[model samples]
Target: MNSVRNPVLRSFCGWLTALLVVASVAFASGEVRAASFQPLEIVTQSGVQVFSVEIATTEEEKTTGLMYRKELPDGKGMLFDFSPEQQVSMWMKNTYISLDMIFIRADGRILRIAENTEPLSTRIIPSGGLAKGVLEVSAGTAQKYGIRPGDRVAHPLFNGH
Candidate 1:
């Protein structure tokens, strides 16, 4: 009985080890990572719209913001924090879905809205003025939700929460 149980335990351990190895490889290859989501609000003239956005604060996360994704559902987005309020440039290199890039000031005001950007284009999308953050949402989100410049953004990253 002992010998039979020992062999079963060894096989189980081997299978577990293989699973862990595969998972580690996927993570190391940058193909899998947990996303951090937070609540964000846009106060438009019409009303306030809420979104559950993934925050990209780390350099690696910001560099790979929404890239390779097939779709971004409505009411979901990615927020990039570029603290210190400087000029920002973005491109759609590996991004497969069209997006609306909303430039935001440090004071949480919407500075500019670049809507309906072409997907997978390398063309530089520049923030016309200094900005502290940028929100990338599904194409037509600005129009559908009445989001515009001078609108207020309520997020923890911005001033006044």
Candidate 2:
């Protein structure tokens, strides 16, 4: 007798759960803005690619990197400075746009490139080793500009050479 009602209840529950998930994501995606702005560039094999970057130097700033924004223009990014050359990790969390994480050393050389990070994911993206900074750019920026692990990051936090 109870089995007859089970399918209807399950269907209703599924719809409710999906609605809840969508609403949660929508709320989570737009809670913060970039802390500060700076001009940064990468000396890639293709050429010098300039970017308008948001500098995240403090804990609060770093934690808020590019969250809640639905769109990011080309050649723009958020730079997260870890400093002191330590192992670092990043995640998508509330970010709405996929990004390319460019892990940088203190001397301003690119160390690793984690491209096309899934939006809103909480997956831990590590630096693979010690990194002094990270630059988060819109997805496809790395391949589009030929930016690679050995590229040089031109910014005051790095060597800037």
Candidate 3:
């Protein structure tokens, strides 16, 4: 009788464990897919001056940018999206590469430029205390490409409003 009871209990436990495992996997996958579905694009400068940017319009996205990533391709960058034009500041915390932070106004005009930010530095890179959008690219990319303050960033998103 004792052996029979033990066998039944073991089987029940195994079944319960398997169900829990399945539930956990489903939950984890849902989370990963949600975060992976962000819309990103590679925009080029010149005609309209578009660059690749990972949309960071929300608070959550602005916080977790490119964190833990080892490398970023050329002409690739992150674009911080904002609902309204406001002064914005950025920092290089846990970031691995030096970058040129280009601040843009609501009209897509380049407002200010912060170049060569040290990797992992916690220093606050202010956007001249007023900016509606911010773009991050490899250090010197701004200069090499002749991107300068007063240059307009052409994008449909920045069309006259």
Clashing pairs in 1: none
Q: Taking the tens digit of each residue's C-alpha lDDT, what string does model 1 give over 1-161?
A: 54435878889988999999998776555454326889999999999999999998888888988877778899999999999899999999988899999999999999999999999999999999999999999999999999999999999889976
- Candidate 3's residue-wise lDDT over 1-161, tens digit each? 54435878889888999989987775444221113223222233543344566666667778856554556666777777764778887888877778888888888778898988888988888888557778887888876777888777754446452
Q: Can you write out model 2's per-residue Cα lDDT over 1-161, one digit (the tens) per residue?
A: 44436888889988999999887875576545556688998998888999999888888788877888888889888889888899999999988899999999998999999999999999999999889999998899899889999889998998655
Please, what is the TM-score per model? 0.82, 0.78, 0.69
Clashes of each: 0, 2, 5
Number of the top lDDT candidate: 1
When summed lDDT is taken over every stretch of 10 residues in candidate 1, the lowest stretch is 26-35
Q: Which stretches of model 3 miss by more than 4 angstroms? A: 1-50
- Comparing 1 with 2 on TM-score, the higher-scoring candidate is 1
Candidate 1 vs candidate 3, lDDT winner: 1
- lDDT for residue 5 in candidate 1, whole number 0-100: 58
Whole-model lDDT per candidate: 0.91, 0.87, 0.69
Worst 10 residues of 3 by lDDT: 31-40
